[model samples]
Target: MKSPRVLLCVRQNTLRWDGEPSSLCCSSCCVLRCFDDRAAAARVNQHAHGRGTRTSLVRHGDPRVRLIAAHRSPLTALFSARGLQQITRQQQSPATQRRMRQQVSSEPQGVAEDILHLSAWLARQPHLPPVDDLLLDRFLYNCKYSLSRCKSVLDMYYTVRTAVPEFFKHRDATEDSIRRSCEVTLAAALPRLTPAGHRVFVHRLLDADSRRFDLLAHSRRVFMLVDVLLHTEPVLGAVVVLDLHASTWAHVLRAPPPLLRRLAVCFQDSCPIAIKEIHFVNAPGFIRKFLDIIRPLLKKKLNERVHVHTGGLETVGKSLPLHMLPKEYGGEEKSLKELSDAWQLALERRRDWFKAEELKRVDESLRPGAAPERAQLFGVEGSFQRLAVD
Candidate 1:
């Protein structure tokens, strides 16, 4: 095994950093060297943390130049981590940027540095799409600031997006069928977080007529609500409410197996939303039968988190704030009609944003493999069941 080498390329004789002393270089204010002890890499990364700083530190074996930068070497892949920070600032307003900076500053040391490193790693992956730091920051928080888990989640996220195109693509909210799905199921992220600081999302069956339902359209609308919720709300996790008051067999039987399999794939592993608890209320006898049929398909951890209420909203009310819930569910909040309408309007306003996100799916053709592994993901039948139970 060879020692890790750090190579630096500078454009000046003296290097300066904010609140730090200058270090002298050589040969027209430029210096390039590869070392074995790896002492220089730590200092290089420390200086690279300064704003608007430019320095190339590449690791190679046996003291060789392994693509430091365009100036010193042929590889231009080594980008300043400042690029990621600039993206975060450009996307947010002055107020939001300041807020984010303050939040990061309050965290333990090296949090921001790890986020920048995560963004840099994503940049090097040829198959992945670009993501803003805001989203990455939330994902880091979701993973408890663990870089390895964050990377795995992001990888599955984009890969699953490609494999499950039906839910992710064509997310325009103005379509008639999509619009109907919204009205049929009163779905929205409740305005108030639970006592534990988890966002509360509720789904109720408004239109009892099962014949009017389209599984695909309903699934798409549900995910749309979820996407907007996770992006806008800040919470420790999420608590899902499924109120199945008037659902019938017609609605349950209409869901196809393939679609259920895809939904399971995205919801189970692809999504970054951490579901704290799932509560079922106003459930009927047949609903249990449906759950029994699909029970074997769910993961054990998820199955353990599920709760079927035998009483009223009191059980759910204990989990969520009463004043923030819909009045129908025994809370002091607005009625489901009011909350759903507000969310529907919000979704309409974000139609353009959702359309833009549809283009973020991975291009499997360009993936560096003989063939993408997507076919095997959805190829098995009866391996998945629908959590989209109305």
Candidate 2:
């Protein structure tokens, strides 16, 4: 009697439906109900048929010859124990445990490599000041915080650790050591503010094999560095201003608004970067929240004694909108030239606006809801205009 022909069907990118058999196989006694590929039969016959070619083949089913679906294929299960067992007899032996350990040991170091790569890229920037090792440490500490809070980050940290050198064992080194390494790398590198340069560097760092570990760390560090340098480096001030104008900080502060506000003023009077331009794009709503917290502080006139050494356009642009003040305060908006002219007129009158009753009243106005808001109304408006125009 002639035996029934058998065929095995394979799925391509199709989802395996529930209760539907994901695989097909043929046996000597049973026929496949719905397989697609008959082409495989020739190969199977050539490979497995042992009976005389002339004789009728029996349709007995062989459990070993079952068809495995793509999802269940040995290749698909490459990471499974059965697949790994086929690698080498040595791997099958006790050596497998050691191999696993070796893999585990290198991940943290790999993470370190990614951190170093990012630091190196940032160091190459022309507009940024030379970052010190301590700064890098701060960056790494931020990474650690991210890892502690996010599982995905922890996975990246481990993957990087696995690629590290033998001497840099994760078990042997503490978080502080890695942090120090980060700081050292940053300290050794210089900052560059060219948009083209920064974008290129950012791309490279993110392309790293296990990039996520240091993502938040890098973003926060770069933004903070830029923010600080804006208040300090006069030469790079214009570029930072341009960036603030073109970009927003929305990308970095994915967390709550309160936290974002705290970060904005966390440096406190330590305006390391020149304050020519401030943008809210990177962290949308960040600047407004910052202003809210700072309004009361400004009303206190704490910065009154502080000499804000603003130069260039900022110095020339220091004018408050009069309308921004309440009607009772005799406030009116004035142009840059007008503000400058007003200041000059005040000088001619020998009336120091800084010491005038208006200034004192504004200072005293810092006490209650109505008056306090006015003290800030002037500076906040000024800061916003400067940031916006920059």
Top TM-score prediction, candidate number: 1
What Cα-based lDDT does every candidate model obtain? Answer: 0.60, 0.26
Clashes of 1: 2
Which ten contiguous residues of candidate 1 have the minimum total lDDT?
67-76
> Which residue segments of model 2 deviate by more than 4 Å?
1-216, 223-253, 279-390
| Winner by lDDT | 1
Model 2 agreement with the true structure over 1-390: per-residue lDDT tens digits = 322223222222121111222233311111221122343233334423432232223232532232222111112121122222121111012243343233223232343354455556545433223443323332333233232222222222222222211211221112344333233212101122222111001111112123222433432333322322221211212212111221134333333343332233322222222232322222223455544544543323332322222222233122212332212223332332333232223222322321231111112222223221211212343342101100
Q: For candidate 1, write residues 178-296 as lDDT tens digits.
A: 88887678777766545555567778876779988787887788788777654543334678888878677777888765666677667776677777788888877777877776556
For candidate 2, the lDDT comes to 0.26
Q: How high is each candidate's TM-score?
A: 0.69, 0.18
